[model samples]
Target: MPDLVPPMLPATGELADATDPARWAVEFGWEGHRCVAYVRRGRVRLLSSTARSVTGSFPELAVLAEQAPPGGLVLDGTVVALDEAGRPSRGPLLRRTATLTPDAALRAEVPIGYVVTDLLWCDGRRVLELPYRRRRAELEKLALAGPAILVPPSFGLDEAELVVRTAEQYGLDGLHLKRLDVPYQPGRRTRNWLRVPLRRRRQVLLAGWVPAPGRPDRIAAVLLALPGPEGPRYVGRVGIGAADADARTILAAPSGPPPSAVPDGVAEHARWLAPGLAAAVEHRGRTAAGRLALPSWRGLVPDDERDDDLLDMPAAGGSQGGGPVSPDPVRDTGTRARDEARSRPRADAGAEARSRADAEPRSRAGADVHSRADAGARSRTGTDARSGAGPAGTDAAPVPAAGPEQPGTWHGPLSRRLEQHFVYNTLNTIASLVRTDPPRARELLLGFADLSRAADRAEEPTIRLDEELAAVRAYLQIEGTRFGARLSAEIDDPAAAGVDPGAAVPPLSVLAAVRRGVQEEIEPVPGGGAVHVRLVTDPGGPSCRIEIRPADAVRDPFVLFSVPLDVPEGL
Candidate 1:
């Protein structure tokens, strides 16, 4: 067997506005860690894109070795951790990746599957020079299917839009387009193979670290910057757990020059680091100022591995584009509880936010459902609570316009960054329901569509309390579907049933807290969990209170301020 080598990489590219069906083929871009599998003599070895061995991280994939035909074989694909709904999820996969040799308990908790998309070598013959279509043909002939291995079909260019829709429905990363006639070039990011992401993700250079508020000795978040013609351009910071090994790494690195023109209110106590540190960060989109909104740290990687070519890549048709008004995640804004959550494992807001606000943005169509216009212009057409359009009179509440300083105003997007896995899991859950309970599936599907619009809406910093509640309800509905009998949710919003549902509240205010409850309180419980939401209207102002029941000694009921003064900061 030959020594392992870096796998071929796809260059960032836009889907061709016009394409010949015979020349292009598309595959769903699985949102998991990429790997190359080499199977020989009933043994399998996995290598990451950096050519680092990671076989121990995914013992479940060893089934490939047993299924391999006579002679060794080399395959390239992604190693995905499927959630309960059997959707490819990055969080579980990251957990596995963080620990190269996870214990059996962890392994059972996060079983993974190998999604083989390319065949590099088979029957002891190298196929790197073969055209992609031929290589795929050879790969399919192997009939690679197992408990943990799969070979998904590719679509013709004519089906690209359909494929994109399917990927969006299932919360996939995006689509990978390959030139049917081109040969696989090892370790090259070429235009012949294009990567179109459904959401924004990039390798951000770590500029430095910042101390958690009131804790000078502890590292909280890492400042982010991007290489530019002038110099390193300051983007924003992404919060990290103080105890994370990554935090220690940032603290130990020597100081480098500060990024050009660090934004005010930031960089006050930032400790700059020399260049070379980088992280895989994902966000809903860029703010009006080009700063990342809801940036979530995926993991740390060597700066040299940063894909400079992928920077500035334009979104393809049907892709989710970033909005202009979302707040930057680097700001210090939220409650101390949220800050502490940011310091835990999977510390980003996505997980803390029930992965609803944390999950990937919906399709362009879902985003367009709600225009950025004020509450009045954002009404839904249907009255049915379960309808995809969402509850009737979605914008029926007449809200007094308030400035950002108003106590009741809720500004900014969700508290956490959007992740890809939750979206996939939600879709998988909905898909499974289509057969077992079609009506329930339909309701959840519509509810998800409603939540997607809320998640992707490019709105003013403040949204109507009703809209926020609607998004929260949609998320609960989806979670209910995922957990089924294990979870139950109830919303007592008498204020919404009456008038004034349009009271302006910060975006993702209640949702973020609910997400925290579901993630920390509900999801972890063995017998399942319950979420109870109550809306109380008093003279002070209308307050939204969410309670995640079956709490432990450590966790209390989640409570939202009657009127949140500001959006939670630092996703």
Candidate 2:
């Protein structure tokens, strides 16, 4: 096994408008901690994005090391804590990760699952140079069956939209699209992958805070504003979704003078500051007044971000005002409450005037005049009652009609369903193998264990090409045992080819190619068939390539069947 390195990071990008289904594969972008696992000879090490050791945080993942293959392997994945319904709960995961010493009770309460996405090394071979499809194939050959670790299922481009829609429905974050032919590039941003989020995120200015009543040092809500034509316009105030630490940080920042004028309908008591801090906010949409509706603070943004960046934001619409236009005091109960407190004296005077007018009544007029007055009073009262207004003499405003309901997004149960299906099928296959050849079944079982162990390694980035080939051969042997003589395979690498069996290749690259051929081409035939795999070195290049030729020269079976294309020709 080779020395481990930092995990490759995915670049953030928008999904392309149109993409070829054949060229891309999609996986759910989980809402949890990004983790890189190194498994060496049965020891597992979990590292966070910052390369900090998080091994103690998730003890369940240690099983990876015990189940690893003979050689070491490195895995890039996510650590997610699932809720009661089995949906990834980011809050729980965050809490779990923050604990320095996890107790048994905490572990039981928040059981973590590692969702392996990419394979960087296996056995002793470095796989970063292999195409993504090939790496996926290699990963599959590991046959990851997890109580704690499992490979996430991938979808085709045609299923991309459905996958994302399902993710949202299931409370997952979004979908990640990775190009099939691109190789892994560690710590570098590339177009090989794109992330499409379920929610839109914006960076806005954090201009001030409304202090918590008694805890003058604490913030009840932080005032968020965005750059406007004139200057910074108040978007809204965010109290929810921000943690206590965030409040403390905001308070610690140096305070400056308030804005020239407070936005209309905003709390006059809001303590303002210099307009330099920025915050990342998530919301459903903007109110009619261009204020954020149900705005949640994601976190503070870089201090260097400029207000001009927000000028192009779509004019959000709702009653919540973003600027001087006051939100309807009648409809906006929150604003009305705050304003009513400040103008209580004026409200009382207005009530007294109304009472005096009512007291003067019909008796002061003649019969005809009194009748007209009675009719006018009845009309006013009736209209007020219908409009949801309070006592005529008070300053109460009319209630607004309910807004249209937004349709619920679909939460696809695809992830769990597919996982169940895979497990069931694998168990059934194992059962058949046991009935046919118990000794061979034992070997395959050990192979399965080895694959699992390899995936669990905490160290060792690259495995020996020979060891990787061995694992693939073990898998092929298992399949051969199941199908008997009907299935055959040939490894054509010879000393004359000048290819080093000891040369490093991505784990499972060879095996994945062979397995893909068997599954798509050979197994589908009326009778099983043979597959030929040849390993060759580039004459003047530093790369090794594997050439796979199935018995039948059919159109690439993967392309025909629309399965994830996993060939190693371009390696």
Candidate 3:
């Protein structure tokens, strides 16, 4: 498999009202290392935001390679370590990542989990053209779960505020809101996704340091500054929340003369340093004098990681609810749009411009021309069955089904054909691994056999209740190996209710419904939950109903479909 590229990132922005839930989805903003993982065949590759390979740093993430669906899969998420309260803690995660080759003892103490938020590729195909909702559906199909990997729940507009509040209450960083219609753009930062933080944090340059009283060798505090209209200006001092070793390191760095004009009271004891080191400072809010209030050191920003915009000072006298004000919204939007447009692939620029120019003239003549061109394109390629033809052309022929058309048949030209090919290739790949890893190979081979048998009999007109349950259980067990404890199911069998094992029902119907219920209703929950399947028979009627529900309520809107079972005539 080819190497997977690093994921596109979102630009930093303030949160705004999301009045339309259908176009937006929100999730918790995890405070940890941003990592993008690629699972190819049975090997895992993890990359940091800077495209640095960190695969050796987190051995726990190897579970992703085993649990990921066959073929190649690429995921974007954060590597977080949870505190006792189950909330993400950045300190522990940092310590773990800092060690390139952690010992077993350190690994046990600071175990990390990957909180997956987006799916970029699956089954050897790049899914960047699909909308976010579709990508999320494909992600859930993988049933990603385990001690090392997790898929967090997402919420709609109505519950977005609640999610943010809940995150704040749980001591989380904040929330991330993404537009559903936007496609993934590699290496580009667009407004399609916005991040909102619960507290104020900024990266400031380390200007100078104050020597400890009566101990010239030791450091008292570090002076931080933000870029001013003329030069770097004193913002505040970081005196707390750092260990003695950290303080010593900052003070020991090469020093030079103080700034041309030092702020009053700071110059008396401050020793200036060369302007290269930077620190991430967290604080309550800015004081009336525009100085940071109660600032504490978070960590040092790597020398290569500086962004000039991040250091730009906010306009003076601009305050929001007594908190540090954000940059001008109007200016920020214009700058962001320009940057995005400039970053777009140059090859697409000409075509995009031509299309935009052609779309401007909406006259009847233009419409007719566009209709003819679209019809010609469809005639050359085959009309899509999923999206019916427009008024300009007649509907094209439907793609042929692999077998007899069934209720659960999928007719997508690309997907249906790829399904069997992908599965066969996966089995062959696993079989080859048997020489080296017999145990895992054995498990995968058994799962492959069971799944193949179930698929072969799926089109049968009818099957026994016990047979259907067996197939469903086998399938769940296979998927469970991938998800670990994240995916779970409890079935109350019909035999427990005294129903005959020989009772006939539509083949694969119950299994289809249960799988759909879990994917749509259960798996999307942020931290994952359980799914319960119950068999309920009507006392007065001839019909039997299967109930499938998740342990947690779904926040996104969904449509439910009912499938009728085929009963033998005159039974």
Candidates in order, TM-scores: namely 0.41, 0.40, 0.39
lDDT of 3 by residue, 1-571 (tens): 3475657777666557455788988776887888889887678889988989999998878888777667778898888875432446666677898888989988767667787888888887888778998887777667675446667666566666555444443445568888888888778887788776655455677788888899987778888886643457788788734455456556566665565446778899898876656666666444546577778776665433333233222221211113222222112110221233332221111223223212222222223233336433112112221123311233322322122223224323222323323342333344344445656655554554444434434433344555566656755665565456777777667558655444444445555545544444456655455544444443221222333333455432121212222232333
lDDT (10s digit) by residue, model 2, range 1-571: 5445676666677667327877898777877888888997658888888888889888888888876787778888988876533456666687798886799988866777788889898888888789998998888778665666657666567656545544443445567889888888887766678776655355676678987779887788899876543467777888834465556556665556554346755557787766556667766444446567677766664332322243233222321121222111112111112222332211111223223222222222122222335444122222331234432344433211111111110111222222223322333355344435555545554554343323221122233444555555656666676577778776644345554444433333344334444654466666666665544333222222222233444422111100011111223
Name the best candidate (by lDDT): 1
Separately for all candidates shown, the number of backbone clashes (residues 3 or more apart, or on different chains) is 6, 30, 3
Q: Candidate 1 on 172-251: residue-level lDDT in tens?
A: 55688899998888888788888887655556777888887899768777899876534577888888653355665666
**Cα lDDT computed for each candidate against the true fold:** 0.59, 0.54, 0.55
Off by over 4 Å in 2: 200-571
Could you tell me which residue pairs clash in candidate 1? 334-569, 349-416, 358-419, 410-505, 410-506, 411-506
TM-score of 2: 0.40
Q: Once superposed on the true structure, which residue ranges of model 3 sit more than 4 Å away at CA? A: 200-571
Off by over 4 Å in 1: 83-87, 199-571
Candidate 3 lDDT score at position 98: 85
Flag clash pairs in model 3. Answer: 152-526, 153-525, 153-526
Query: What lDDT score is found at residue 219 in candidate 2?
Result: 83
